[model samples]
Target: MKPPTVFMGEMTNREVEAFLVDHQTVIVPTGSTEQHGPHGPLLTDVFVPQEVARRVAPRVGALVAPSINYGLSYPHVGFTGVVNLRIPTFMAVVEDVAASLATAGFTRIVFLNGHYDNTYAIAYACANAADRLPAGVRAFPINYWDGMTADEAGEFFGPTTGLHANRGETSAVMAINPDLVDLDHANAELPPFPAVTNAPAVHTAFFFSTPGSVHRASQSGTWGDAREASVAYGERYLSVVADATVRMLDDVERTFGAMPAR
Candidate 1:
């Protein structure tokens, strides 16, 4: 017999409506198509979050929606194959996507994000789409890496992880598929401007950038040590993200299940 999958795209519409009989939660994977230095795939942002959403959905009795694979990646526009949407366009897409699912009766909507720029877009989309939805529905806009500790990043990435196309992301992609990366081409190149790397996990010590600043600062589009990436580190990242998502799923149900259905 074929085993069940959490991805709703693979299921028939009947199967999806059937899922609502037992589950009201759905995870929407958000990402981008942009440069990841020389080695990492353009879709690394999407693939990483997709891995966690796929791994955790069945365990949480949720379904994974089709990926929102393009985002507002203007900085990477200088690079080939970078497909970025305007900020407003991305938000509209997200709003419609969320609204469609809510219309289908899913109450707990999760936007699992991989790209940093999409942060505000997802939040704003949720707000715009919420008022029109049926009562009791809630949308969660999340950056999956927010769950990672500075210590965890230090342990796996040897003190350097996020920023862009670096060890942590490259390693995670390598674990997903070695063929997706070519380590020989990997290299490190931080932004030319001053940037602090030692803030706490959830806190920021510096402001991000001016418009087009990232493009001016990074020629290669890598902002961390990509050479340090490895398959081992990627495996750990997958496990960590999946574990964190599972725990959050529990919190969503416990905290909101008691509220009257909207």
Candidate 2:
């Protein structure tokens, strides 16, 4: 039998409503256009999640929404090519998107996020939108990496695992888009941070643009070793993350039924 078609941006109105009517779950790919060390692509943050969504949407019989390629990346501004949305602006955009989908009758809206900085903002947007949505219309935001188990983490990043451009991320990108990676420039380095820090670290919208203190702290903006990254390992990691995400969505659907009639 043929696989269920995942809707893309080019889908017609009838096709969209049909998919919604048949499968209430809609997956939205969220990522950032930021620097990812010397070898990885600037869009690495978005590419992984997008690829995962593309692979899983068909299996779960869900429609794929156009990706929100920009995210909150103020911390990586100094590295160049890193574009980020202000916290408030990002929150507003997410809220508006969720509200619009809820209004259109999508009961289960799943946000498949790739960027770490957008986590808090996305969470806030989901909560705020849920409050405004009619009963049963649930908006869920998930950090893809958070779905990984400790065992999986260990498997991906043995010991040296820094937050920014870590081994797991580099490996995943290499597996997904090997051509984009410039192995010659790949370097492993981790920046030092204070023992304690508060949320939002810095409030400036463009603090990532600073050198030394910003992304340059790491020689190549890479936090972990990329030498261990392999295509096979990446495929396994992607499968595990996608499976966990599907299970989470199933749990959410069971917890919240269809939306109430207007």
Candidate 3:
């Protein structure tokens, strides 16, 4: 017999009801539609977490829920084909999604995040929805990047490159589809001017945190160099993230026990 479907989208209402018989967990992957430099696809944020969630759910005995494709990504909005929701709007959406899952009887709703900008919004939204959740039903978010070690991430992205459309991310996109990324046209970029320096004026980490900072800092829309990105590294990154996510989900299950009967 074929293995059971892992994606909720592919399951019918009855299938989902059947799943709930033994499973209370569901992975909701969230990503953004933003420019990821010239080499990376606009959906780079979408693809990464979706892949990791799928890779993780079977091991964790969870189903992968449909993803949230838009996010609070104003920083990359200046580029072509970018769409960003206002912070309040994104938070509202996140809360609604979580609340919906809770109502649907999914006791453990995990928002697996792929975008940097969606971090606070997801966390705050989940927390905000807590009052509405039925007792024992829980919803929360986790960044996929957090699954990797600093040293491991540093290996793929290098120290100077922030998480943007850089080596690590581009490689991930390549792993999903090599044709989607154009290595020949790829460029190595860094924050211009004082951003590259240790000047006290520029707090290096938050330099690109401001809205529209990505556009103002680099015309190519890349926060770091894509020159070093490789499909090999992408596959490895995916494997590492997948394994780590499995362990993380294990911890989540152990930490939060069972949900009440819905």
Consecutive 10-residue window with the lowest summed lDDT within model 2 = 203-212
**Candidate 3 lDDT tens digits, 1-262:** 5457899998888999999999889999999998888888888998999999988988878999999999988877678998989889999999998999888889999999999778878999999999999997879888886767777777755537755888888898899889999898888777765434665346435543577777887888877788988889899989998887877776776766555544
Worst 10 residues of 1 by lDDT: 201-210
Best-matching candidate per lDDT: 3
| Candidates arranged by TM-score, highest first | 3, 1, 2
lDDT: the better of candidates 1 and 2: 1
- The residue ranges of model 1 lying beyond 4 angstroms of the native Cα positions read 153-162, 195-211, 251-262
Residues 1-262 of candidate 2 have per-residue lDDT tens digits of 5344575576777778877777777788899998888778989988888888888787777777888889887777677798878878888888888887778778778888988668778988899877778777778788776666788767655435655556667777778977877777777776554454442454233244342345645556777776566677677778888887777666666655465555
The TM-score between candidate 3 and the true structure equals 0.89
- Give the better candidate number (1 or 3) by TM-score: 3
How does model 3 fare in lDDT?
Answer: 0.84
lDDT of 1: 0.82
Name the TM-score of candidate 1: 0.88
Sort by lDDT, best first: what order?
3, 1, 2
lDDT of 1 by residue, 1-262 (tens): 6567789889989889988998999999999998898898999889999988998888888899999999978766668789978888999999999889999989989999999878977998899988878887888788886666666646544324447888878888999998999899999886544444654432222223334445666788888888978999889878987887777667666777777756
